[model samples]
Target: MTGLGTLDAWVGRTIGVGWLPTRRDLDAYQLRCLNETIGKARVESPFYRSLAGWPETSHLDELKDIDRFPLTTADDLARGDPSLIALPLRDAVRLVTIPTSGTSGRQKRLFFTEADIEATVAYFEHGMATLVRPGSCVAIAFPAERPDSVGDLLMRGLDRMGAIPVALPVDGPVEALVAALRELQPAAIAGMPVTLGAAARCMAADGGPPLRIETALVSADSVSPSFRTALAVIWGTEVFEHWGMTETGYGGALGCDAHDGLHVRETDLHIEIVDADTGRVLPDGSEGEIVITTLRRRGLPLLRYRTGDSGSIAESPCRCGSVLRRLRLAGRIGEPVALGDGKRLRPEVIDDAIFAVTGVIDFLVEFRSGRHMVVGLVTSDPRTVDEVRSVLRSHPAIGPALRAAGIDIAVEIAVDPPPPPCRKRRVLGVEHVA
Candidate 1:
């Protein structure tokens, strides 16, 4: 049986107690797991074998050599053949299908074995230890009945730690979820920040029972710091952020107790930040596209896969004592825009400038183009809508990025009633007809 207590203790000790692995030790283990998984893929999967010259050695000549492998992108998998299905169907126990947000593509089905599900549950057990008390409960806003879904896996993890887990069917109304939460009064809540934020709004409006939630885990979307603070204020608890995708078996990385950058599951995966255009690896602290290699994945293993999230890696020692590094995922990959004056705009940089404004309690950025770029913002304050626009207009990057993109952009602000929920699209893009 997987030992939840032991893993939880080790992780806690790693962070604060004592005796964590050294950098050298972690590297050796990563190399070993990488080699083992690669050997399996080459032997059992035609997709890997079809590579013109798959590395045959047991060891990587240089870590940078990983970039030489072709990136497994969304288009590649959407058009993939049966041969790319790495594991035998007999051994595969679960399947997860995700639709591409691209303008066009079929849903991609990911296969996993029982071991994969177990691995995910084990990670959650340790990760959730930061929030779950042995006798308490976890309120999940996602579906838990689906076979091997993230909610189900989390329930198993919490169960192993002697905590109860409850959820309303995902498709069910949020009001039902709010009522159940009021009844269960779980010690921790897990859901998208927006979903929780929306639920908090419903509770505030309906004057419901106190949830008594101690902490929360927010995932499945990007949120601004102000937005997170707003969510926390409604629920009266700290929100711990999580960043992951279905491709990573929904268990890539999570924030530690310190609530700094997220600590990647470096033991089971290797992460890299690469220049989006050149695909060259960037040094720590440089913002770029995120590339991931699964060290322990069995069915449908991914190597040098582009995750399409914009983020940076920080190797500096964290506030926590653990040796593991952190990833600062800013948001999803952005589109290119040419400024009316011929300077290319940096969308993420604009994101920084807009979010940095003092009164932007929580906001959504909307862009519709014409001769110039027109920017629309939704903010928390309904009374000072124009003032919010003034703050953004005075930003250093917004004007320059807009002017450089050669698009005639205008800034509009609206004072909305509350924080944006998970269902709120942070960025809404419209094609420029001109």
Candidate 2:
């Protein structure tokens, strides 16, 4: 079993007692926090107070009683209601506005106080300890220049852990990132999966001495198995996956050395899996849309918030022997685009097949009309274009879907397409031919 570097102990200390908190201990603590959060939300937030059928805090006798609360959807947040904020505007230290994908110009705004950000920093400090040693030098590829940015918070966490942090821009040219890695040769790296995968392939193409990096933390996007395999094969580093978003304060769950599944930050947040259609909470091990409720967040307490991400909670204990619950993520909940013959194009499936190609660095996917898929590639070797096409044709999911829809695949090798506006990658939808 792999060591999690005082992580289990820290969780225990935060929740119940020492490092070995039991399920019962966790349930008790969560119930207390839930009641407190509900009471505060009802009294302070106009949105919560305005809800039609909110029950009194006393109704929540146990953690499962959380189902009594109505689910809060992304539309609720995007409504731009100031009433959603439980605290005064002056009390908020940070405000994050995220444009809802697939929605026309709709945005969800989240507010965070200093305490909320500190909670994230604390979580990062402990979770990252699982990957890096005290004196390790880590390269951060996520945005870091701004105050209260995810990378800046990660840097602070590393500082607390006695590790050195190097800021590498995620949006910068791949050549620049490769050069920085060659110069610093940091012991560990952290970034979105695609950006890190590109850097790894670029560095490998240079054909010099191998980087001494031992571990990596990939987040902010759904990590495909092929990306992990490629990173390990190219960089000779163990990849740890992290699951979080801006709404969760950027630190929700982190994988330990065991790598079976990610361990949730139970002390800070309560996670539930609910059926997407019925809004009914599902049992552990049942895959459904992820629902989250903040147990301790103060700035804006989200009660039974429906996060559109699909995932499940592990029924069994972690092999690493941590009392924290394990979360197995299954990417986004719904299909954004539909193909004919009851088939949908999942970008994650395509990502798996495409990144598995050896010379591929990155690619942009476009779903055009007439059931056609266009892939624009940035590859280390020109020959990879043909190989990528072959891989996609032979892929189990992509092949069948395309064949069923009578979709023809087109490949265009490019020098470099413009970086995505955000860190997460998705398949673009185009209505007409150019």
Candidate 3:
């Protein structure tokens, strides 16, 4: 695996990386890849045929101005445009569907070719190396029983590394998950944060079977500070975070031992942080919506695809020894509420306010007209609501922030199984009240 062979191993060679691109080499490679994708889309994909902001085929300099490209939103994919698909259905090896948060909205569909799946597996082969040593058994809690499921691809990668993966998809109750945990004491586990958080709570409450797990890889949602602390204390393991979406064909970025930020898959994708409203690319370290361009994707080559999740790029290099940049994720852009005084209250603020109180499973800070907040909660006991209210009231800034803006909050804790697993419950969300 020397020189070009190593390069071939890195990219699997449809795009052909002759060498590991550095600073300007990175830009050149991305530009070359982007142009090729654009050219292909113009011919095959119906969507990019009429799609705007394509730079002149020969002029690579124009690629620097990516703002010229149209922003692909969740709505774009939801509409089920035939033109978005670059290849015929026969060419695809896998397809994934993502349902949006709202009750009634179009589900996003993603198509992956064999090469795409290989790319993902290769990424996991390298990514999981950060957490588990070779031959270590890991309880893969992700739903991988299906074809090309994240779990399957990860398992394939683990096989390459000699890791024994207990491929368990999170499909049942927390008790079932706990039962599996008791049976197979795998060294590590990776899955959705909400699902895993619920399992953690269940195990902690029941004093359930303690496994020899060393790490929990939580992805999709940002882990609240209190929840992370609880998992660390109860499970006695380091909690590593992952950031990815359906459009990313699953895994996009992963954290290193330093845990400063998630190392971006820079060679395969180009990520940008832009002001949500203006579509202006923010400087590194400035929080904004994450937009990505698939530098080497063949299926649905999304140009400047706007992912509604909010986060920023690290301004400095990571101690992880990789030159690839990292992303610092905040909550979803839609999760924050704007006040009459132009003040914005992030959901994290309320998370600290409520989770500060004990016996709380989860909560949703829904906002109504007149800046009113309905605190929907799931708690263990009678003391939960009052304790939650007390914590918010005790917060010097929360009280003043709400009072100055004429906002009122009402708390409601459910006695029954509120809605679903506590993890699916939002700590802060906005709902329009007519």
Candidate 4:
């Protein structure tokens, strides 16, 4: 196994493309990657061997037919044997398995080889290169478990770059985290938007330390622009949003220096925007589900995996000079709140409205049906209900859409808040509360 320092140097030297390759260059690279990936998948993975047919040596264009290759879904893994690893079980240097949080009913078991871990760390290094400079102290507020988890991997990467990393675990009491932040006084912070928002509130109440956070990296859930603005005001820093799934290693896209949208890592992965209803590809700038093909994954590879995210693409080159496609993620496709009308409401819109209400501590929105939604605001403010109603009524899209859907507005402002000490407080569109 390579030392962390050596791996960091190699990543810093050759991970990301300095300049965006031309269309011809990208095409050639894609074809080469496709050939190599298909060859390996066919030879090593039994799941793919039965699904993906052999490719001809001369006709490379046949790879464009995605239908020829069977789609691999989370369900496929649920039914298969766990020992069906692509590489020999003994040769696997390091094995790390983390059951997903189970956002869906079924939990996904993720297997990572030592090489997969290294690749993930390298990806983070490449992504951070756009924002992090040497010697920057990064305060990580994600799940920091012992041995090796995603959070541990991030800490290792930051250390390799000579940046101080403060791992503030989100599992324990919030007061403990507050104390740790005061002691560490990091230059940058990274975590889910909800965690960062709570930390920002703590900082606001305590008149936080004098240190200024230069950049804030947010991930793990959909982030609203209002939440980002609030966090920036509290921390006196810029928030950089990142998008990735547990299955796709760690992160697939990063917010460029422009900060307008996420620049897809074209060199490491291929991205496709397809209509959520039909799998047909959509033109650039159209909102659709995201499908990704991993170019360099050796362990638990994914081919055209449905990400279930709704976002659009920015066709032009980013102001940062990277030609990689930039994505504007709206929200999860299956989770969108359906109005009584044909139209649907994005979760971000509700987040904006919820944050606008003053004296609201924590809240959850439940769509009882297309016609009604219950808003639970955790605040003692007597005027919280009226304020929420006023804001919802004023919004042109929200009000009109709800009216068209025949949704009778039901607002419940609770004086007693729900149990705290959880990672995220706001659970939007929750069908049931455990």
What local distance difference test score does each model get?
A: 0.67, 0.83, 0.71, 0.66
Kindly list the per-residue Cα lDDT of model 1 for residues 1-434, writing each as its tens digit: 11133443554343343545666666666777776777787777777778664555535655666666666676656766645667778888987778877767687777888887887888887778766778777888766777788888888888888888877444555566677778777778888765676566556556566555778887743556654665566677778778888888888877766777887777577888989888888999999988888877877888878898888988686666556668887777754344445454444445545544433433455565445444455433444456555655566766556555544445566443333443423455644211
RMSD of model 4 against the true structure: 5.2
**Per-residue lDDT for 1-434 in model 2, tens only?**
24764887788787767657787888888889998988888888889888866765535887899888889988788886746888889999999988886446788889999999998898898888888888889999888989999999999999899999999856768877888888988999999887888888777776776776789998943688888888888888898889999888899888888887888888788999999999999999999999999989877888888888988999988878787888998888775447765667666888788888888877888888857899999876888889988899988888888888899998888755765323766678733110
Clashes of 4: 2
Clashes of each: 21, 0, 1, 2
- Model 3 scores a TM of 0.83
User: Which candidate ranks first by lDDT, i.e. highest?
Assistant: 2
- Candidate 2, residue 126: lDDT: 85
The stretch of ten residues in a row with the least summed lDDT in candidate 1 is 1-10
Prediction RMSDs, each to the true structure = 5.4, 2.4, 4.4, 5.2
Q: Could you tell me every candidate's TM-score relative to the true structure?
A: 0.79, 0.95, 0.83, 0.82
By TM-score, the better pick of 2 and 4 is 2
Residue-level lDDT of model 4, residues 120-140, one tens digit each, is 787776566556676888889
Question: Candidate 2 clashing pairs?
Answer: none
- lDDT of model 3, residue 351: 69
What TM-score does structure 1 among the candidates reach?
0.79
Q: Model 1 off-target regions past 4 Å?
A: 1-19, 53-58, 61-65, 169-174, 205-211, 335-426, 432-434
Residue 273 deviation, candidate 1, in Å? 1.7
